[model samples]
Target: MVENRRRSEEPLHCLVTGASGYIGGRLVPELLAAGHRVRCMARSPGKLRDHPWAGDVDTVRGDVQDAESVAAALRGIDVAYYLVHSGSGAGFEAADRRAAEIFAAQADACGVQRIVYLGGLTPRGIPESSISPHLRSRAEVGHVFLDGPVPATVLRAAVVIGSGSASFEMLRYLTERLPVMVTPSWVHTRTQPIGVRDVLRYLVGSATMTDEVDRAFDIGGPEVLTYREMMCRYAAVAGLPRRLIVPVPVLTPRLSSHWVGLVTPVPAALARPLTESLRYEVVCSEHDIATYVPDLPGRPLPFDEALSLALRRVREAQVATRWSSASAPGAPSDPLPTDPDWAGGSLYQDERLSPVDASGEALWRVVEGIGGENGWYSFPLAWAVRGWLDRFVGGVGLRRGRRDTERLRVGDSLDFWRVEEIEPGRLLRLRAEMRLPGLAWLEMWVETDPQGGTRYRQRALFHPRGLLGHVYWWLVLPFHALVFGGMTRNITLAAVKGAPARVNEARAVRIRGDRRTRRTSQR
Candidate 1:
């Protein structure tokens, strides 16, 4: 019976509603890896970055609010992952509540088999059950979905422990920045934290195993530790000794949310939901989920183990952006070096300027000619090879050509470089498409003053990921200089040659026209 059920739902064609979110962003890739064809539904289809397999999956731009769009997005989608929440939207609770109902109904109408959601996990059966508005809303959203549409397989989980996640980022920044911590009553609350990997496994694994479960279930990591303990464990994995953790009863969730905004990268809007949920004890009530998701059956992730792995992945992603050619094509061939001396990823930026006598117009032409037919103005072969490798990292290889022969505009994608900023004869700055350990930018400018016809300059900017990220900058200084200098010189020479020819042609045309007019007058 299990085999038949598994085969019937084999390679589930899944549709994720919040494919652009952090969880959904990771979930799309996970679902695909599990032999499922995924339709990534998000508010902005363009927001979907260039993943190597980006073309394989379907992408639909639709909001949960618009019934028509939602119905269309859910059409033919088997397992629709309800990853959306009211946090960032206009109608926080009402909008989310309504949207889920509409989507659940739409999913039912569309024949979707399951609606997988990751929401807040609060102990519901307790005698004096008191939960915050945020937790209550989350629970309501799940219940509304499960009751209406397809069998809703709700995976109620605590704050996911990973980088780039709001909850995780709040925790990460609080511990990293504050060597001496202050007090929050919620710090003493016992909670079960789960690793992102386990959460993903349970969500994907739930699709195949649906025999006994008809409703929502709690999903958490292996340990039930206090908020303070979770913080200390995170510190240990970060290789830092735990600082003093003091729990104060006076600090309210409102006050704590603001404090988080000041201390963590998490903004106030994001912090409030997490901070509100922190008031209640977020632990699993039953262990009956053993037979379903075997990966997490025996044990949940140790706080330290989850922290180490999640941090490593974030570091890797940051660094991956650096070395990956998609970060910047035709960029100086010099990549940030691996200082085994550092951990995770290397992120660093090097900036230098060399004089190249090129006209603004000529330089503009060269910049326009970048990518596609002309190849990158600097390190053409290296750029091509790098782009080819980026294809391995799941990026768009040098396929998209320029829109026009000589014009540029914003929002236009040029090969790997999205048109970030453009000035006709002066500046062209491109954000890196290739992966990097951190954020990076490449810029070329032709500055023309009254005294100077044009001055060509190039800059490479990198934002480091961590300690190693800083080290990456110092190591690649010389090579960046070399590659950047060569590119600048080439652009200068190309522009210089191009300008005079046009000038001479104009002069010659004027002389010929003058002679013709003089002869006509004599006649």
Candidate 2:
């Protein structure tokens, strides 16, 4: 390929699947920064439209399981990054195997030069059957690529220490939420965790490797620490007093996953696989990747440094992509909010319309700034109770706050909801991520009334699935007045109070501009 020249020497056309996912979202910018042309393949390309680098790359709607789509995405691509994985769930292994096989076959048919995969690192001596289904599925996917006609490089990593990563979030929540933790036996298991930066470096470098390298490489940081030691070190790094972690033998992976789900923002479906994989030592067996990628000075950051970096990102809210960036498998497939109510069966709506005293822009500002630190303008205790209930049922709790403080994006996660759609200052629609029997959406709109005043329209819609869905909807119907009604009243009041400041700021800017113009005219 390209007469043995370094891939860096010539810009390679790269196709990144799962562009909306955590790793794939971060990897695309890195590849582009290195002068590689990137084409992203996503099932919903709109999810990526809000990304800063979205305009620089080409995005196509495609699913890995669809052979025709995969083949089309792979065409005219030098290297294809397989970042899409069926996350740990029931029947995930089969789904992973099928997707990998399809992707490998499509890559081969498309004449792709290289295929790079990021997979979990399995224990050194353990058999595939002994490992967790998540890790085994990952290994199987890697093997499928390596065994394919196209040359493939599989980078196996242990726990990735990064802000917005599932592993780091689990550790962060567990350590921060509880000063004393009754943990599972897996806390003593050893793991060599790697930083997200190093993982991306290795991934980008793999694209340029000689065609001869097609096997799997274990990638991790220099230090290896037990889960207990990591938590202790994390507490220390976070400036918290040492944690009390009691390892109990009675807690199985399933129980521990539930416990983690209750305590952390990560749902049980994801936490289960993570806790299961921690049962064995996942230290890197070899550092053979350095021979090709070659680590730079202070390249693979130490455990504490990685922890510090991740913490800093979390504190600053600079995390680029979160684990929630990718929707869970089998997410609700109901009709969108734009669709007519009749299209979706048995649609229930709790609609509230309030006339606001403030400008539409002011109302919009309050709407966009809702959630996160600014608690939902309704009943705080009710929202907290609802969040706790969701966590108890293995749903993404309200702890998964908004990415930015005052900005609303198409795919941003706000509390227990995901931003399904946003029309600038006009409309903000959020889909429920909490565990519910039916699909739910909350739509907030800033509109101008006939009298030329700001009008705030709020609607909570639910499309019932079955009998249980209808029961669930009626069960929560009584609280709608306090929850939805209070929101309408408080939001408008906040906008009214905030509108004067906005007007003053605009006036001040105009005054300064006028003075500057006067001085320019005199000169």
Q: Which ten residues in a row have the lowest lDDT in candidate 2?
A: 327-336
Count of steric clashes across candidates, in order: 16, 0
lDDT of the candidates, in the order given: 0.69, 0.82
Candidate 2 accuracy as lDDT: 0.82
Question: Model 2 — TM-score against the truth?
Answer: 0.67
lDDT string, candidate 2, 421-486, tens digits: 788899988888899865787889999999899899988877554346668889999999999999
Per-residue lDDT tens digits for candidate 1, residues 264-350, read 556687788789888888789865555677753445667787787666633332333333333421111111112011222223445
The best candidate by TM-score is 2
Per-model TM-score, in order, reads: 0.64, 0.67
